[model samples]
Target: MHYVESPTSPLYSSISNTSFSSSPSGTFYFDDDEGEKSDEEEEEPDEEEKNQSLEEVDVSVLKTFLNDKLHQLGEKPQMEYPELDLIPRCRFRPSDYILIVHYVINKVLNYPLPCDWVEDAEELYNHNPELIAGSS
Candidate 1:
């Protein structure tokens, strides 16, 4: 089989100016134009252009998409962990879910997490005592 990568593919630039061919023996060979460089290899974006591209991404869209995907995973089943009872399970509460989403968004955007972001459920309960009385 012979395969030609499309120029529009994200991986095209990395494997450009090359073609792949497989023989009946299942051996693959890469035919590369060693003397020539693809157009993509010649052009590089400046720092300002990279920043502009990042700025163009809509954070709200990313949040919504991530939330939807998380929800699709379904609620986690409750289980006892006697040895690890001191740990807080963030998957049990709606607010915890939001916190998780925000944490992920902040990570993706290279933003620092809030000082109050708690990983331990016990610590979270101590910070927001009222949460302990509420049922999941």
Candidate 2:
């Protein structure tokens, strides 16, 4: 036995003929009247505009935020690893270590390091012979 749907069936009557249409490519799409912007039509900020916005941000605000984050990091309890104690004692203080990290990060980012930081980093390097061997 085979079941056939007639044009007069309730299912056929409920669906509007205008709801879908076929394109020249033989692909069917819903006919929508609401205007919507496509991805291509949307405007994005240009490099100049992005740079201007970045320039507008206060340096002090960024500094304060960095200081707060660093303070929080310092407040965290230091974890002790017994195996790491086999190495010679590091001469760098916590602040000096932070300075060294900042120096390295600045170098990696290709940003200019401040004169004082360079001097401090040199001093720390001179004081620590172990770092030289590890670096090599």
Candidate 3:
């Protein structure tokens, strides 16, 4: 199946707006909005905070905002997703799900997370004092 990406797809931005771009290995953005921001852009506000209030709201609020706008414009929101094979998927172990979920929730809430949560979790899980076996 062909995955058509339109510039105006709000869900593409809304759901994609979640922390999907942040990967343990590298950046992976499904939509253009998540792309690299130059220094000038970094100096600017996050896409959500640009025209909206600086108070970080849940990403679900973005969905609601899009819904209100579309309804007022008399347009129905549609999301045409690429096939599972076509989309890039990240595989995480069961042990990894907790950290991943917490991290995503923090992102949705616009809370700050460590630069690399996976690396941090790994360092803790693999090299913590409990596992050091008698070394002070």
TM-scores of all models? Answer: 0.35, 0.29, 0.21
Q: Assess the local accuracy of residue 70 in candidate 2 as a C-alpha lDDT between 0 and 100.
A: 48
Writing each residue's lDDT as its tens digit, candidate 2 over 19-88 gives 5333333333454543555668645656654444333444444344345444544544234434444445
lDDT values for all models: 0.49, 0.43, 0.42
Query: How many residue pairs collide in each prediction?
Result: 1, 0, 0
Give per-residue lDDT, candidate 3, residue 36: 64
**lDDT: worst 10-residue window of model 1:** 20-29
- Tell me the tens digit of each residue's lDDT in model 1 across 7-109: 8843345344446433333333455566666678554655654445333446665566546544554655224334443445443333434554666457656
Model 2 / residue 95 / CA error / Å: 5.2
Give each prediction's root-mean-square deviation over alpha carbons.
16.1, 23.8, 15.5
Comparing 2 and 3 on TM-score, the stronger one: 2
